[model samples]
Target: MSIESGMIRWKNRVALVTGASVGIGEAICTSLVSHGMTVIGCARSKDKIDMLSNDLSKKGLSGRLIAYKCDVSNDKNIDDMFEWIAKNHGGVDVMVNNAGFSCKDTLLEITGDKMRDMLNVNVVGLVLCTSKAVKSMLTRGVDDGHIFNLNSMSGHRLTGILNFYAATKFAVTALTEGFRRELVENSKIRITAISPGLVETEFLARAFEDKDMAQSVFARCESVIKPQDIADILLFSLSSPPNIQIHDVLVRPCGEKI
Candidate 1:
């Protein structure tokens, strides 16, 4: 009903965001800090994590954001990351499974390696990480928590250029919804997916390699989005009343071509 200053008193909440080294994941970390929430930020790059930790300190957001180097693609690392979480900052109350990637390939260009790697990282990795987070929650006696999956419009519609990526995201959507239904029966855990259209971020920039091309992609996009936009949604989802659950949310830029 009423929201203020992004609910800047996430006082008692703990959030874990995977792939938080940059882009949408990084935005989620910073957004949560602004909301007065402490977060566990993970990525494979130690340098990136250190950078984020320092940034948090400089922003006067110290002690609220901790960084961990985690390679979600590995089951062992997944266990280690959550184990550290459980042993350290208490069990997470919210988990944001945003660690994902897409290779430069289409149906025609797809190779066994490309397709397999993409699926392994994007889909398999997500399931493993989310499972570990939930495990900690169960042990902590947290009857309820939140899970947010970063999905894409491709998950809902066909886009030839993104065939493999779409398949992985589609799987994520299904996984989230399926778990949401089951979790509602007992635990207070709520799982939801948010599909964001072409966003202006390093992800696209790195994918295109050329600034102009990346800019063009976002320019003609039905509506260019931003990482902060998705971050806002994450905050909103976590801030919703405990009994209320948002099943699936899709956001795109206006007038953008899909």
Candidate 2:
């Protein structure tokens, strides 16, 4: 089936994306807006989202992008954002839990506050978002709603230095499966875990605290996935026939070893 036909059900529907200011999150916002969805793109940096919205406006796409400022790590912020979404758009039909945080500090070097920061964003925040979205879907009688969690390859296997960050993603991996089990017999609500490796994004710079180092690492790689690539996979999963639940997707750039 054509993408248009596949996404017909989603046209003009309300969708919420966390961390929508940058990287895979930004690309997903662009893709969804182009596909004719009313996308609420939330990030701590609302200005960036507005800039993206402005850029997208010139395209005359079928859908629209709304900028929202939200720090997913904060419960009040998340609640406020969801409340606004519920009031303005009548609850979301799609939820993308794409916000994430990581630091280069290894287990030995990481502090309690830093560890909590990662858990708050990477695990707790994601869980809260998922719960809220599921509630919205259940209340609105929207059985076919979808949720996307931007997981990582690190979630599945241990990355030597980034082990703690990987641990949080590991929680996500288990949550994805556990969530699927909960929704199976009762609802058509779909949850997808997208695990990607070595994507060219601001992630590495943030993780390593050095843009040059991140660039050098990327230069060493033969190829790397683009943010748009992840967005495409998202659309692909969404467009699939409803019966086929795309449980998990593991993607890596060509020849990316470990």
Candidate 3:
């Protein structure tokens, strides 16, 4: 089916995306906005999102983009952003838990503080955001709302030096199923986990703490996934029939080995 036909149900709907200042999150926001959805892009750096909003405005999109400042690790920030969204947009019909981070240090070399920070943003923050989204859906009586969690290939298999980061994503993998089982019984909310391998995004630079290294890693591969590629996957999942629930999607570049 065509995108317009499949996603007609989501036209003019509201969507909230975390870590939306750049990369995959930003791409998702752009795609949804182009599809006539009111998209709220939340990130720690509000300026970046604001810039993105301006850019999207210049495109003359059918929908609109709103930038909101939020630190996913902080409960107050998450709560405040959600409150503003609720007041301004009514409630969210789609929630994308895309905010996450990874430190370069190994498990033994990593400091407790760093590991805790990773867990806070990747696992706890995601869970809390999901909770708020669920509550909003329940209160607003939105039974068909969908939630997408941005997981990683590391979540499914062990990767050297990224073991700790993998653990956090594994929690996300489990949480996806946990949420589906818990919420689907009472509501039609759909939960999906998207695991992509070697996406060319700021995540690599942040994880390596070296732009050159990040570039080199992608250069070695003949083809690497792009943020837009993942965004397209998200759109496909969101456009599925109400009876079709896409539980998990693992996408890797054709040239990627692991």
Regions of candidate 2 where Cα sits further than 4 Å from its true position:
none
Pairing residues by index, what is the TM-score of model 2? 0.98
Of 1 and 2, the candidate ahead on TM-score is 2
Clashes of each: 7, 0, 0
lDDT of 2 by residue, 94-194 (tens): 99999997999989999999999999999999999999999999999999999999999999998697889999999999999988999887899999999
For residues 1-258, what per-residue lDDT tens digits would candidate 1 score against the true structure? 444443544564889998898889988988887667778898888677678778787888633678888888888998888888878888888889898888667778789987878887789888887777787788778876788899888788876666788899889888987887777676888787989877788776664456787788776666678899999887787777767888788897888555
lDDT by candidate, in order shown:
0.80, 0.94, 0.92
- Model 3 residue runs over 4 Å out of place are none
lDDT of 3 by residue, 9-112 (tens): 89899999999999999999999999989999998888999998999999999989999989999999989988998998998889999999997898889999
lDDT of 3 at 3: 73
Give candidate 1 misplaced runs (Cα > 4 Å).
5-9, 208-211
Model 3 scores a C-alpha lDDT of 0.92
TM-score for each of the candidates: 0.92, 0.98, 0.98
Q: Any residue pairs clashing in model 3, and if so which?
A: none
